[model samples]
Target chain A: MEKTQIEELVAKYNEGVADPKEIKWIEQLIESGEIDLTQLRELSGLDEQIQKMEVLSPSLNLDDRFYAALANEEKQIKKGTSFSMPSLSFLLPRLAMAAALILSGFGVGYFLQSPAQKSEVSELSQEVNDLKEMMMLSLLEKESATQRLKAVSLTSEMSQASEKVTNALFVALNQDDNVNVRLAALEALKPYVGKSSVRMKLIESIEAQYSPLVQIALAELMVSIHEKKSVNALRQLLENESMPKEVKTKISESIDVLI
Target chain B: MEALSDNALMMKVKEDDLGKMSLLFDRYKRPLYGFFYGLNKEQELSEDLVQNTFLRILKYRHLFHGEGDFRAWMFHIARNVNNDHHRKKRVKATEDLDNWQERIGHHENQSNEMQHNEEHNMLSMAMDRLPEDKREVLLLSKFEEKKYSEIGEVLGCTEGAVKVKVFRALQELKVIYKQLEKSH
Candidate 1:
C-alpha cells in the first residue's frame, strides 16, 4: 500500500468508523510497524490513562521482607566465598618463599651467635617465658572454661614453670568452676609433683574438691605418688558427711594403703 | 556522579557484590509492583511477586552475562512467578468454589477501596476484566515505558510483535472502558 493509503486507513480507524476488515488491516499495519499506537486516537487515550493510573505504593512490610531476603542471600554468598581453596599454582610460589625465609632464619641464628649474643638470646628466652607465664595467669582468670583449659595446657609447653605458674594451677585445681579445667590443671601439676611444695599443695587440694570425679582423681593421684602425709587430708575428706559413699570408701582404702 | 545503571548494579551483583541488589530493588520495586498489581489487582500478592522476581534475580545473578537489559530480565522472572502462582491457584480453585467466590468478593471490595478517582476506578475495573495475556501486555507497555524491543525480550517476541500486542490490548481496553463509563 502507498503511504497515502496507510495514512487514510489510520485516519479512518482514528475516526472510529473502521469496519472489522479495516481493523484487521490496521492490526497488520501495527505488526508491520507502519502505524504506531499513538496515531490511533482512542486507544492512545486509554493507554495514556493506563499509564497515568495511580498504583498503591508497596507497604514497609515488603521492604522488610526484601531486605531480609537480600541479607540472607548475601550471607550465603559470603559463606560460599570465604573458604575456597587456593589453586596450587597460586600457592606454590608463596609456599616456596616462606620455606626459604624459615631456612635462612635458622641458618642465621645458628651461625651468628657468640658469648654475649648467647647471653642476650637467653635473656630474650627468659622474657618470653615471663610473658607466657603472665598470659597463662590472666587466661586462667578468664570466664570461659575453654580459655582456662587453654591456660592450663600452656604449661605443658614450658620446660620450667615459675612459682606463679604453679600457684595458678593450684588455684585452678581447687577453685576453678569447670571440672574439665580443674582436671586439666591436676594433670598439668603432675609433672611438678616431684617438688615438695607442689606435693604439699596437691595434698592440701585433696580436701577442697567437692566433685566426686575430682575427688576420686586426687585420691588416685595421692596413692600413685605414695604421699603418706595426704593420709590426714584423706581422713578429713572421709569425715565429710556429704561425701558420696563410694568416694569415702576409695579415700579410706587410699589412707589404709598409705598407713 | 550519576547513579549506577541497572545493568551495572546487576553485573556487580553477578560478581558477588550481592549488596548491589538493594540498589536494583529500590529502582525497580515500584514499577515492578505496578506491573503485577495491574495484572493481579491484589496489593499484597503483587508485592510478593515483585519480591519473588528480585529473589530469582539474586539466585540467578551468576547467569546474568550483562549483555541484555536488567529490567527486561527481571520482568521475565516476574512473569514466571505470576504464572506459577496462578497455576497453583487454578488447581486449588477446582477444589474449592466457596473460597474462589470469597476471593472474588474480596477483590471487588479491595478495588472499590483503592480506586478513589471515578475515571481511574472505571479504567482499573476494565483492566481487571481483560484476559490475562492482554492485560499483561498493556501493563508491560505502561510499566516498561513502551520500550517495545525490551518488552519483546521479556515476552520472547520482536519489537513489531510487541507493538501489535499493545495495539490489540488497547483496542479491547477501549471497548471495556466505554462499557464501564456507560454503566457507571
Candidate 2:
C-alpha cells in the first residue's frame, strides 16, 4: 500500500469507524513501524492514562525484607570466602583418624630410639626449628600485614628461638609498617627480655619508635622488667620534638619509677 | 565518586562485591514492585515477587555478563518470577480477573487515594480484565517506559512483536475502559 493509503487506514482506526479488515491492516502498519501506536488517538490516550497512573510506593516492610535478605546474602558470601570450621560431626571421624596416625607414629619413633637415634632425633628437631625460623623470617619480609602477623605468632610455637629469630623480631618491631604486627613482634620479644642482648635491643628500640602506642607499650615493658638503662633512651624519646605529650609524660613517669 | 553504570555495578556484583547489589536493589526495587503490583494488584504478593526477583538476580548473578542492558536482564528475571508464582499457585488469570472488583474494593478501602481517582480506578479494572500475557506486556511497556526493544529482550521477542503486543493490549484496555465508564 502507498503511504497515503496507510495514512487513511490509521485515520479510519483512530476515528473508531474502521472495519475489522482495516484494523487488521492498521495492525500490520503498526508492526511495520510505518504507524506508531501513538498514532491511534484512543489507544494512545489510554496508554497515556496508564502511564500517568500512580503506583503505591512499597512500604518500609519491603525495605526491611530486602535489606535483611541482602545482609543474609552478604554473610553467606563472607562465610564462603573466609575460613570456617567444618561441622564437628563431619570432623570427628577425620580427627580420630589423624590422632591415631600421630599416636602410632610417635609410638614407632619411641620404640626405635637408641642413644645414637636419640642424638639424631635431637639433630632433626634442631633442623625442624631452623626450618621454622627460616620460614618465619621469610614471612616477616612479606608485604601483607596478615602474613607478617602470622610470622610473629609462629615464634610462640618454637620451644627455643635462635638469635636469628630474635633479630627478625627486633627488625619487625623497629621497622614493620603495620602497627599490629609491630605490637605482635614486641610481645614475641618479651619472652627473651631476660637476656642482656635482648634487653639492650629493647632499650634501643624505644628511641626508634614514633608510634605512641608502641612507645607507651615499651615504657610499660621497661617498668615491668625494671630495666633502668631504658631511662636514658626514654629521656631521649622525651627530647624528640615529634613525641606526643602523653607518651612523653608516660615515659617520664616510667623514668621516675625506674630512678 | 561518580556513580557506576548499571553494568559496572552488576559486574562488581558478579565479581563478589555483593554490597554493590544493594545499590542495584535500591535503584530497581520500586520499578520492579510496580511491574509486579501491576500484574497481581496485591501489595504483599507483589512485594514478595520483587524480593524473589532480586534473590534470583543474586543467585544467577554470574550469568549476567554485563554485555546487555541491566534493566532488560532484570525484567527478564521478574517475568520469570511472576510466571513461577502463578505456575506454582496454579491460579488462573481469569480467576484473578473474576475477583478484580473485590480486590479493587479492598484496595480502595486500604488506600483513600485510589478512591479519589475514578478514571484510574476504571483503568485498573480494565487492566485486570486483560489476560495475563496482555496485562504483562502493558505493565512491561509502562514500567520499561516503552523501550520496546528492552521489552522484547524481556519477552524473548523482537521489537516489532513487542510493539504489536502493546498495541493489542492498549486496544483491549480501551474497550474495557469504555465499557467500565458506560456502566458507571
Off by over 4 Å in 1: A83-259, B95-120
- For residues A154-214, could you state the per-residue lDDT of candidate 1 as single tens digits? 9998868999899989999999889999899999999998999999999999878988889
lDDT of 2: 0.88
Worst 10 residues of 2 chain A by lDDT: A239-248
lDDT of 2 by residue, B8-29 (tens): 9999999989889989988988
Each prediction's DockQ against the real complex? 0.51, 0.49
| Root-mean-square deviation of every model | 21.6, 17.3
Native contacts present in each candidate (fraction): 0.80, 0.71
Task: Please give me the DockQ of candidate 2 compared with the native complex.
Answer: 0.49
How far off is model 1, as Cα RMSD? Answer: 21.6
